[model samples]
Each structure stands twice: as C-alpha cells, then as structure tokens.
Target: MSENIGDLFQEVMAIKQAGEFELISALIPYAGLVGLELIKENAGLITILRNKPSNIGNTTIPAVHGGVVGALLEHAGIMHIICECDTTRFPKIINISIDYLRPCLGTMDTYARGYVIKQGKRVTNVRIEAWQSDPSRPVAAAHAHFLMG
Candidate 1:
C-alpha cells in the first residue's frame, strides 16, 4: 500500500519544529495564500502571511484580503497551540481574532509566527505577527484564543 498522506505529513511535521509552510499551503484550499517564511521565534509557533499576484477582481489596490489574513492567523494559531500539547489528538479552534495593522504591499509574501502565551485544560492563547518584504515591518497582528475540545 502507498504511504498515507497524513503519515507523510506527520513525518514532515516531526522533523521541523518550524513547519513547512509551502507544504502546508498546498493542503490549504486558499490558492492565494502563499506560504512565506517564518519571521519570529518560539516553539510551536506558526504564521502564514503573504502577497499573491493581483487577480484584480478580488480586492481593492491588489492587496491581500483581510479574510485571507484572518484565516491565515487562525490556521497559524491552531498549529501553534496544538504543538504546545503533544496529546493523542489535534486541538480544535473555538474561534480566533485577527486585527489588521496595515495593508500588505509588494509582491512578496508575508509570514507570521504564533506562540502560545497560555495553554490550559480548556483554552489556549496565541499571539502572531504578519509581515512581508521585511520582518521588521508587520502588516498585521493577531491574538487568538482557542478552546481545546
């Protein structure tokens, strides 16, 4: 039998404390979501922020959409909080909050890193930053609270 994709992905996850955003991106449905490199540090942290070609019909001024950025943060947060707890299962997200700091410019993709500030029996708190072209300048930031199921 062929090796399982989940098994392969899990193997990939085991190797890199920092996940492969490109591979992860492939699994994500959003095609516009380009996987940028990690900009910050802290274990179990994951961030996906990036710019894609202006489809023109999507948004104003050809910038990344807020919804995509929000979804990225949510995904990053889930990846992060779960890393903090090596349980027999993946943590579920009750909800997430993302605040846009600025409009992401340039043709480059932005990346965010989410670190767990708190992980308890019921919930987890994550903080993430989204930046592009330069990590020093972040286009958006988010603090997410995830309810562990």
Candidate 2:
C-alpha cells in the first residue's frame, strides 16, 4: 500500500464516479479497519461515514471512542488532500488537534467533512467537522496539517 499511492488515487476516482463508496475500504485498508466510507464527492468537497460497533468505547453512554473519532477526522483529511493534489506520494501527517464538542451517539452513523483550508508546496492544512444527526451541531471538530511532497 505504501508503494502504490498513485494507483490508489486512480482507483478512488473510479469508485467516486461509480458511487461505490463501500469499495473505498478495500482500496484503502486502513479505512476498512476503521469502517470508513466515502459517501459523496463533488468539486473540492468530500464526505465520509463510519459505522461499526467496535468504535464505541463507552457502553454506558453508548459514545464513540475518542480515538475512533480522531482517526475518522484524520482519515478524511488525508483523503481530501490526496484527491485535491492528485499526488503520487501519500501525505504524511505532521500534527493534528481535535476538539470533542459533544457526545456522539453510538447507535447512529457519524458523518464528517474535511475542508482544505490552505495548501502550499509541501504542507496542507485541513479543517474537519463531524456530526451524527445535525451538521450545525457538530460532535467534534479538528485541524490537521500534512506534509506532502
């Protein structure tokens, strides 16, 4: 997988056109493990969904794990950068900071969007927001920076 970023990018494009969001997990295995799916793509915006029982960390509150939320945001951000730049090299995450605003209901499917705020020759910054039911009431938000070459 590390040696085939270009191939993966091409596959992603085909899947996007076909509206086969489920196949994204197979093309990007980490996404498969995390139950991440590309739901929509148009222009420069992309939406991601994650639904898996293993993602829930607090059974009492039925809340998604903090780590899982973080992974979803980071994964979305990386995919956005890849699709935007169409680069052969996989972007390396430099740093990220996530803010958990509310409890994400475990029984619901969570959706996220990663917006590319700025892109330079070697670095890209992205803003991510996630919600379960209402986009206006996001459960978490994050900012990520990636080193692209």
Candidate 3:
C-alpha cells in the first residue's frame, strides 16, 4: 500500500465532495488505529475520537489517556489544515502546546475543532479545542505551529 499521504490528500481535495474528507485519515495509520473520523459540519470539519476500551487510562475516573487526548488535538489541527488550506503536502508539526482542563471520559466520544490563527508562507498556527458532551465545556485545548513548506 502506498504511504504517501500527500498524494491521497491531493486526490481527495480534487474530488471536493462532502464525506470524502474522511479518506484523509485512512492514509494515517495512527488515525485509523485510534478510530479518528473527520466529520463535515455546517461550520466546518471536526475530528472525532471514537470511544474505545483501550483509550481509557484511569479506571476509577474512566478517563481517556493523556496521550490520546494530545494525539486528537494534533490530528485535529492537521485535518483542519489539510481540508481548509491549499497544500499539496502534509504539514509538519513544528511545536505543540496542549492544556488539559478536565478529565476526558473514555466511555464517551471526544470531539475537536481547530481554527487557523495564522497561515503564512512557511508556518501555520492553529488552535484546537476538544470537548465531550458539551462544546461550552472543553476538556482540553492546544496551540500548534506547523511547517507548511
């Protein structure tokens, strides 16, 4: 199987159809392994981390793993850039800073949305927020910079 996500990205973007954005996650093994899905919404696309037993970290609190939350935040930013930006290649992460505001329940699905703070020639800055149950109450938030070139 080809592992070139950029090629797949180009193909998907060319189609420009709703529901095709999920294919972008297929080229990313980690996203598939974690059951990440890109959902097209009225506002824009949102990333969802499906609830799974493996994602649970604290059995008592039944919280999702911190690593899992971080991964979702990062992937949300990537997907946002891919779907919204005019890029032929996958963006590289320059740096990311994430804050965990509340415990993410592993039993429930997690949703994340990213907004582009700035898109420059060489760098793009994005802010992502993850929430469960309610969008008003976010479980985690992240700010990430990606190398667009």
Candidate 4:
C-alpha cells in the first residue's frame, strides 16, 4: 500500500506539472475511496470535495461520518504540505483536532481548504474548514499537525 501511494504521488506530480487539473485527485487513495475531488482555483487555493451518498454517516439527519470528515480535512492538510514543500513522501500526521459545527448534509457535496499556520523544518501546523454550499458556514473545522521530516 505504501508503495502504491508512492506510485500515486509520482503520477500526481506528473499531471500537476502538466496542468491537467482534474486528475490530481487520483494520487490519494483515500480521496478516491471516498469520492474526493480536487478543485484548483485561482490564487493558489486548493479545494477538496466529497460527493454525495457514499459519504453519509447518519441516514436520519443524513450527516457525513465524522471519520470521513476528518479524513477529508486531513487529506487537505497533507496536500497543502506536499504543495508547499519539496518531498514526495507522504507526510505523517502527528495530531488532528476537529470541531463539528453543523451537520454535513448527505444530500450535498462537502468541500474543504487547508491553511498552513506554521511551517518548520520538521513539522507543520494547518487549519482546515469543511463546508457545503457556503464557505462562510463550515460544517466542520480542524487543526492538524504533521511531521514532514
């Protein structure tokens, strides 16, 4: 699996350099498993998406699973680090703290963006927000630490 991830990273970097845009999401296995898509916007911002039905955690309120949300946020942070740094090896997640602000309605797609708060030689801190429909109203947010070294 680790080898596969490395191979995926190589493919991702290749497409990224080619500016293919849409295919970058295939680099992360978890993203593909959960239907996460990568959207490249202007001003160097990256948005991650999780499409509907497959991500529902609760059918009653139709909320996305907390684990899925966390994974999505973590993936964003990982990507942010990858883009900001020079390494192809996957960053190791040191810790992540998530805040669930509202129910992630399973009917709509979920989106997230990660911000690198502090970056060091061996570690980095990132903040992430997940939303549906409106960026101002995030369904969940997270603070994460990663060991890039």
Candidate 5:
C-alpha cells in the first residue's frame, strides 16, 4: 500500500496540473479527513481547509484545533515542494515549527500558502502561513524542513 502511495505521488508530481494537484489530498487519508483542498491561482498554489464541526476545538469561541492548523502548515509546505521542486519521491518531513498568532474561526474556511526559502540537494526549507478572513492577518505561520531524497 505504501509502495502504491509512492507511485501515485510520483505520477501526480509528473503531471503537476491544477486538477491533478487536487488528487494529492485525496491520496492521503488524513488530508481527506481534514477536508483539505488545493487551488491554483495566478500567483501560485494555495491550500484551503474547509471548516467542519469536527474540526472545532473551542466551543465557546468556535476556533479551529491547533493540531489541525499545524497539519495545514505542514501540508502546505509539502504541496509547495511537490509543485515547485524537481523530485521523484515524496519529501520526508525533518522538522516543523509553527506559531499560532490568532484564533482561526471555525465557521469559515482557512487558507494557507507556502514559499520555498531554499532548496538543497537533500533538504528543502519552506515557510507557510495560514489565514481565515484576511491574507494580511495570518492566523498561524510555520517553518518546515523536508528531506527530499
């Protein structure tokens, strides 16, 4: 099953189209569970996490779970690598550090985008930011390192 996942990832990476990119979240069960969607804009690709009742962590404030936000940051970084980098295999995460700046409202969708800081032979560094209502005010930001073997 893992081998099949690897093959699917490689195939998707080879195509690298907007529609084909959407298959990535579907390929990973956890991503599907979290309702992650990929969108391609004039600037670049962006990720959206559709809010659902299951994702709500704070009932009083109705905020999104911290873990879900972290997952979005990590996934955004990986998606950026897959779309921008020349690689045959899926990148393995080395370490990820995230900062939650504001509460992500659970009533609306969350958007995230990643930028590649540096791409080395075996490691890639990416920065991701997630926002709910406005792009200027980010709800969370993250830095991640992936081992692209």
Candidate 6:
C-alpha cells in the first residue's frame, strides 16, 4: 500500500502542531504570513520560500525587520511538518532557534530553503536558510526543533 502523506503525523499533539494554515485558517490566520499577501497553502516549501522579493515582505529602512525574517524561517520549517503529516492528527511546535547573518535588503527579493535533518519519534529537527543576491551569501539561517504528540 502507498504511504498516505497524512499518516506521517498521525500521533501529533499540541495546538501548535497544527501547522497548515489552510487547515485552520481561523485559528492560524496566517500560519506562514509573508506580509505581501502570501500564500500559505503551497506544499513545496523548499521552492515556495526559495526566493521572495523584499518588496512583497515588510521592509524597515534599508532592511527587513528581524522578526519578519525569523517568521519566514520558522514558517518554512513548520510547513514540512504539515505537508508530510497525516490528517489523522496535528503536530505542534516545541522550540526553535534562528540566527541572523546578513541584512534583508530592500528592493531585492529573498529566498529560503528547508530540510529535515532528523525526525525522531517525539521530535524533529530542521534546518532552513534564506538568501538574497547570492545563495552563497545567505542573509539568515535557522535550526528548528519541533515536538510531536
């Protein structure tokens, strides 16, 4: 039998584990908000967040807000939990940490990529990176740690 994507997170618990914005729009509102009317339902997070123009996102002076950038990172990582998880249940966010490297420049779009470094029975570890101009010159990167029910 083929593996149903929904079955991946069948045992997830915690309100935060409900990662998909479309699943509970009222509850999540903007699970992956990008400011410029972002789409929160796309399953291809790696490409979805690959590169977003700074124009679409909020900008502060010459750079974007630190919080907004961090959201982008968290959003990218959490998307994986939602897309791969089964509707049988929801997954939750336990703890996450992000590090800023470069300035999110204005007028330029940015890109982000997320990968699952590890997925344990009770927790998941993900790594994400956001870059502008050059992928090698990343603007921000993060390592996410999530908890499951």
Give Cα-based local distance difference scores for all models. 0.61, 0.80, 0.89, 0.79, 0.89, 0.61
Candidate that would win on TM-score: 5
Q: What is residue 58's positional error in candidate 1, in angstroms?
A: 6.8
Candidate 6 has its poorest 10 consecutive residues by lDDT at: 7-16
Q: Per-prediction TM-score, please?
A: 0.67, 0.82, 0.90, 0.85, 0.92, 0.62
Local error of candidate 3 at residue 54 (angstroms): 0.4
Q: Which lDDT tens digits does candidate 1 get at residues 40-145?
A: 3444354645455642224555567677777667766766654456543556667666787877653556676677788777777778777776767877878877
Q: How does residue 115 of candidate 2 score in lDDT?
A: 87
Can you write out model 3's per-residue Cα lDDT over 1-149, one digit (the tens) per residue? 65554566557776545557776677668887887988888899899999999888899999999999999999999989987888868899999999999999989999999999999999999999999999999999999999998
Winner on lDDT (3 vs 4): 3
Instruction: Name the runs in model 1 displaced over 4 angstroms.
Output: 1-46, 54-60
Off by over 4 Å in 3: 1-6, 15-19
What are the root-mean-square deviations of the candidates from the true structure over C-alphas?
4.3, 3.2, 2.2, 2.5, 2.0, 8.6
Pairs in clash, predicted candidate 5: none
lDDT of 5 by residue, 13-42 (tens): 655854467766766788889889898777
Quality of model 2 by C-alpha lDDT: 0.80
Winner on TM-score (1 vs 2): 2
Residue 125, candidate 6: how far off, in angstroms? Answer: 0.6
Candidate 2 residue lDDT tens string, 36-61: 87655555444555667888999998
State the displacement of the C-alpha of residue 112, model 5, in Å, after optimal TM-score superposition.
0.4
| Candidate 6 residue lDDT tens string, 54-145 | 43345444676677778777776776565554323454677778898987875565666677888777787888888878979999999988
